[model samples]
Target: MESIFHEKQEGSLCAQHCLNNLLQGEYFSPVELSSIAHQLDEEERMRMAEGGVQTEEYRTFLQQPSGNMDDSGFFSIQVISNALGVWGLEIILFNSREYQQLRIDPIHEKAFICNYKEHWFTVRKLGQQWFNLNSLLTGPELISDTYLALFLAQLQQEGYSIFVIRGNLPDCEADQILRIMRVEQQQRPKLIGEDEAQRMSVQPVSDTPVPGDEAPLDEDEEELRKALALSRQHMEVEDEEADLRRAIQLSMQGSSDPTSPNAVVTAGSSHESGSSEETLTAEELRRRRQAYFDRQQQAHDSSTAGEVKDSGTKPNQ
Candidate 1:
């Protein structure tokens, strides 16, 4: 979970300031970026969870080599030269459109295009980061890694510094990276209201501490309880959504079949030996299905009657 509005404010501000500073020619590059690049393995020279790797469709982007390999290789050499006292390195990616491109796709309804680059490693914020892109790639897989280094090099040429840090670092590398860069940490930024924030901040605690509570919970206990309730309710409203969608699709298929103009019975009966090709009246089939569901619901309700009553009872001396 990420807080787009709250968590990104600092980075967005930093990026803006960097842009402004670059405009005024107030940029300075540390000579050590190349030295830092040398300390990193060829595998570590990439970004994490890049969309190109996750989505099969975008994978083709990494197959072609960029023309700046020699320049990137030179940049890597320079980073390795100044590797001392470096705490960490991150690759900050920005799409060509910058923040304006940040959007949630309506089809998937997921947050995307937040970074500046069209691909992964577009935003490299670094600290205590441990990821291995090498294991996932077969052969050299040079295009992605090469272009990533090249991109950082370009940013460096534009007055941005990129380097790797040495020694152990914290698990919360993102926050740690910001902190190292003299940035403030954001606390659960997605929480909109004070009440929401307070609710999330509080955890359930028991007044009485049970001793020897070291044993793990019985794996089946909670699962069994839930399963029993699900069986008893027979209401499976959640499951009905998918079934309804499938039924609609089947109905459409049946209606479109030229042989059965109005409707056609789908082959393959789900239960027992029954009429496989016998066309059924739409109304009749629906009634039968409803009756079957009703019977299951009745049986479930009866079986869980005792538990339902127990749940409503008050404790007595």
Candidate 2:
């Protein structure tokens, strides 16, 4: 099996990354596909903005050669299928949400595109073992079927979907070639050490744990648990801070006293016939809050730039 990462392009080109991994050493590159997709997307957006009619022919635009590779960061199943078709490979797509057993040959090479929270990663199965080629990771990591299923289930709950990709071999020669490749992979030397072996092993967790029963955690497992907890805590703190900032901004807009610390005034408000202590309407308050935040953001950005400039300038040392 082969694996590749999008590196700096992971955030916007995950679909392209997966495609590159699947079509390594091909004439076409992921960069080319991305460029083509972006151009088509821009054209389509322009047409839609001009109130272009959606006829049956318009619906099939994606099937046309000019628009086949077009996408907006994420590739639809049709886009992926059409791209693969260019290389003479037929795509067989399966949705993970559908409750149907996949009929696949264990020995044949296959690539699985797993989606979680709009991020994509590739996976492959060899016999009973599964390997994950997540772009963020250093390399392929061994994973368990139970872990894969649980991960997919959590993603589905968050409104994400998974798609499995299987390409049809062109002829018997291609099938034999893949079988040989699999045999070579199986014959590769085993390099798992004690730490790696521990990491690859999956410990089952029961729904109900008996009192006073707990399994000992390995060093790696303990560190991972601590990291996850710290990350969750940091996210919760950020959410609270954002909510508090929004509340303060809104409160400033609603204050009636012009002299109050939280008072906000729009243009021409002071020239109105109403008294200085007049409360604003909900719509006016919202607009004022938005303007206040915009000003605050600009000020913050200016201060940050000045700080950066000062830091960059060396003191007389």
Candidate with the greatest lDDT versus the true structure: 2
What is the TM-score (0 to 1) of candidate 2? 0.37
Candidate 2, which segments miss by more than 4 Å at Cα?
A: 1-11, 24-30, 35-78, 88-93, 96-109, 126-128, 145-148, 169-317
Q: Write the per-residue lDDT of candidate 1 for residues 206-287, one digit (tens) a residue.
A: 6675553333325543342232221112122223333332332243333433123234434333447543444544444444
How many pairs of residues collide in model 1? Answer: 26
Task: List candidate 1 segments past 4 Å from native.
Answer: 1-249, 257-262, 270-275, 308-317
Candidate 2: residue 190 Cα off by (Å): 21
Which tens-of-lDDT digit does each residue in 158-267 have in candidate 2? 33444556555223232334444532222222211324445535545567764555456667445433422211110111222333333333332223342233344332
**Highest-TM-score candidate:** 2
Residue 182 displacement in candidate 2 (angstroms): 10
